[model samples]
Target: MAGALDALWSQYTWALGNGDPRTDSWLLVHSPIPVTLLFVCYLLLVVAGPAVMRCREPLRLVGPLAAYNLGLVVLSGYIFYEMASVCWWCLFSKAIELLDTVFFVLRKKQEQITFLHVYHHSTMLFNWWAGVKFVPGGQAFFVGMLNALVHVFMYLYYGLACLGPRVRCHLWWKRHLTTLQLGQFVAIAVHSSYNLFAECPFPDGFNMAVLLYSLSLILLFLNFYYQTYLKGKQDKLT
Candidate 1:
């Protein structure tokens, strides 16, 4: 059994572009244990966090939430900027991004913590670990850059919305944020699919993984958009 597992692991690593080094730095951050541990903690917190907030009144985390969103904007920007050359930034940024859910849980915004949200965050952690561990560079950085660009706008919107009702009144773009997210997934799917026919150094498995992931997100986000916007509008009209 152990031998079979080892063989499977070896094939998985090869599919992820193991031995392709686009950047050189600390070995510890790229190691599998730390990455796995970080994600495990994130998933545990995802389950435990809301339970802790279950009996408590929702905390109005205006100041902290704003700081958190803006901080991510900066971090995402930096990761996008440095992704082409520095591999550590992607891994570090992904680890820190889990704080997004922590803030949601802290504020008792349970409704915001949807399947799509958890799936997006958890998969990102896992996928980026694979990317950072194996591919770390080349065309693999494209998704990070696009996601970072989307996050800059997404988090900025959230930060402004967190300010209060007055600020949120001007924030008429909430639905558009979902639209942007949908666009991000579409863009990623299209870009990743290009690798199917083109000759690229990036592994085919990585590209296919991205394409499939993006398709899943697209379906989820489309459902969210229809339910949140289209259905809501129709209901009001009826």
Candidate 2:
């Protein structure tokens, strides 16, 4: 049994070594343990955070939330800019994004902590870990760049909305954010699908993974849009 475990561990390390050499020395890319541990901690917090806040008043984080969202807008832009030049930063950005859920928990915005929210946040970390681990650049950069671009606008809206009623009143394109997100998924799916079929240098496996993941996001976001906007409108009219 010990020999078998040793062989399994050797295979895992060999797989890690097979990835982009440029990112081999980079943080969190050396082993899956760091990201896996972070993921586990995120799950633990998701379960424990709200429970811990049950008795306490929800923390008012208007200023900090505004800052956090705006910060991500800047970070996302930087990632878009540096995407082709380096891939590690994009991987690092995923770890930073995990804070989104933490903030939701802290603010006691239980409604915002939906399964879609948790799934998206948690999965991106692992997905990108694999992306950076292997096939760091090439077609993978397309998805990262497009996602970063969408995040710029998305975070800008959220940051402005956090400034209270006056700011939010001007932010009339709230529903449009969901539309934009859906559009992003569509674009990514198309891009990934094309590369999967084309004679591209990027790994077929990664392209397929991206294609499937984007399709899943499309379905989930469509349901969210129906529930939040379309159905809500119908109910209001009734």
Candidate 3:
């Protein structure tokens, strides 16, 4: 069982050019054919798997779900600790972290994937890709740690959401989830900005891009919260 879970993670981890890949170009870094195939599979699963579940009696793998969520938290925490200790591998890990959204898709839950999702998913991979290619051991570590802690909470919500309405009432933190998500971006921007100006090895260009990108996400999420949760009288969360 452990081996199988490791294999699942390896499948995804190996797909993202090992994050700290030897090369920069996608073609030369690794087997694009295999990696692209796996990435496409992930994208398809997220985009289409939900509809399939709605059609097919709702597939449930609570055990894997639990492990995946908590396991990622542990992994992210370790990486964060490593970053804080010395080596900052968050940039590379974030590259492979493109798979984070797989959690939302598998549960047939659209509620978790919001505008924040689009922005984060779309750019996190690219930004981390840039960081890995350009900024080796960049300050992305701080951001990754913050993100992991948030995921501890986010995936806990996901794990409970998987319990199907029996535990749905406990998922009351959706509004705060958005707030927390927004907070993550703010923290990322602030920290990354500080690292940019402070004595650092990473390039200012990388810092600007990531910080700006995260800021854009913050604004988008704030607007989303106001419209979805705050503006509405009733809780329309899913």
| Candidate number that wins on TM-score, 1 or 3 | 1
Answer with 1 or 2, whichever has the higher TM-score.
Answer: 2
Which candidate tops lDDT? 2
lDDT of 3 at 108: 61
Q: Which structure among the candidates has the greatest TM-score?
A: 2
Please give the lDDT score at residue 41 for candidate 1: 90
Q: What is the lDDT for 177 in model 3? A: 88
TM-score of 3: 0.67
The root-mean-square deviation over C-alpha atoms between each candidate and the true structure, in angstroms, is: 2.7, 1.9, 9.5
Prediction 2 TM-score vs. true: 0.94
Per-residue lDDT for 48-142 in model 1, tens only? 98999999888888888899899988887887777687566766677777888888888888788899888888788878777776677778778
Candidate 1 lands at a TM-score of: 0.87
In order of appearance, the predictions have TM-scores of: 0.87, 0.94, 0.67
Q: Taking the tens digit of each residue's C-alpha lDDT, what string does model 3 give over 52-107?
A: 76765544667777666666666666765665542324444444455556655655
Clashes of 1: 0
What ranking emerges by lDDT with the best candidate at the front?
A: 2, 1, 3
